[model samples]
Target: MEIAIGVVVGAILAIAGFILGRSSGRSVGLSEGPLAGSPETDDHAALEDRSSSRESELNTVLVEAIGRVSAFLKTNVRKPLIEAGEAAGADELRERIEHALGALSDIDFFLEEPSMSRSGQSLVSLVENVAQEFSGDQDVRLRMQLASSPVRAVVSGPVMMDVLYLILHNASRFGGDSTIDIAVQAIDGRSLILVRDHGPGFSDEALQRAFDPFYSTSAEGLGLGLPHARSLIEQMGGQIELRNVSDGGAEVEVSFPSS
Candidate 1:
């Protein structure tokens, strides 16, 4: 009996020592494990990705907004201001100055407000605002055929209008007849706006690089219109396409998925 009791106690001590040794070794192994470095590495990578995404977003907004304001100044303000001075008509000059002030106020609003943020707005209203942009241009005739009812979409209203304006502006620039045709329709759960210009059709290279930033065929342009327009549209989960119509001009189609 004494021998048997001694044997049992020795076995228990041996088992306890083995368990304690394994526990100590396992604790050390966990700290030195292959996956121990993963958490920190993954965290660093995630931070980098977020930073890159934010930088890209800011760059897109900066480029597009600056381009938009520059074009507005050139087309709507500069020439008018010069002409108002040369003509020396008080009433006309006052009107032009007032218009310039209003446009400047709009620029301030665009910069201060979240004009590029997404929201639900009437697609028809957006298109109308784009058409209004050409109201002062005598040579550019703007026409729109919108749906009988209001077509709703989820997008940034200001950004969408700007994009449409850019497309229309480009069309007028290239279109030979100085006439712009805009059509809006809702089909297959999407809102589609088509801007047609009777200008010379795009060449193969132009078609391929229509959305390439800073690529312009004309000497008089900054070439950021289509690229900015495309970026805004794509950010809103929409699409913009440039194609030549068989009727001898180019057509730009803007489509946004309806809410």
Candidate 2:
């Protein structure tokens, strides 16, 4: 039991370390950095490539092992513990366990390299649906500036909607009762989803660590929302940008290929 607990803890730490050490984004479609004629630079590049490869291999193994552990914990440990807690009226224990499980879910999403295949979906409809879903889930209002022409984006609609929903959810969570402004536009062969929140725009530190896992401006945040959102978007040939709107708000713009 000691060894089993140790392994589980180790695996969880491994996942945390992997994310905290994350640099250079995902391992796909990245351009080589700063090539020069110097032999020293070439040597450094070779070492970096090998290190990067090794890290990727470690991540794969860690996820497979941690996934099994997570499943077992959920079924054998988490459920029983939660039930016992409820029966004993150990509300604090149950809440702590539940919070850990929730953190694990976010970490799993943040760590995985998603392979999202795209199909042409109407960007406009997805936005509308996501807006509706958000409003239904919470007492938040979403205002839209949809394109005049129907824009078809080469992306999975469901995944995109989830990503959009997450963006809105974050806005609503932090932006208080202010209305969220979302704009869908097609520009330069790209489909853009712009989410702007009328909150205290990101601080300099927040902007700097915008997508870093486990970094959050809110005391209540576990902080993987934007990082996971970026991973999903990047996998599907999309990109997310963070900026402060000059007019006292935060803006997140996601772009994808327009079909």
- Please tell me which predicted candidate would have the highest lDDT against the true structure: 2
lDDT of each structure?
0.70, 0.74
Across residues 99-139, which tens digit of lDDT does each residue of candidate 1 receive?
Answer: 76665554343223245688888888888876876667546
* Candidate 1 TM-score, C-alpha based: 0.58
Query: Any residue pairs clashing in model 2, and if so which?
Result: none
User: In model 2, which regions exceed 4 Å deviation?
Assistant: 1-17, 20-115
| Residue-by-residue lDDT tens digits, candidate 2, 62-127 | 565456556655664556555554346567676666755664555454445555767899989999
Cα error of candidate 1 at position 241, Å: 0.6
* Candidate 2 structure lDDT: 0.74
Give candidates' CA RMSD values in order: 23.0, 8.4
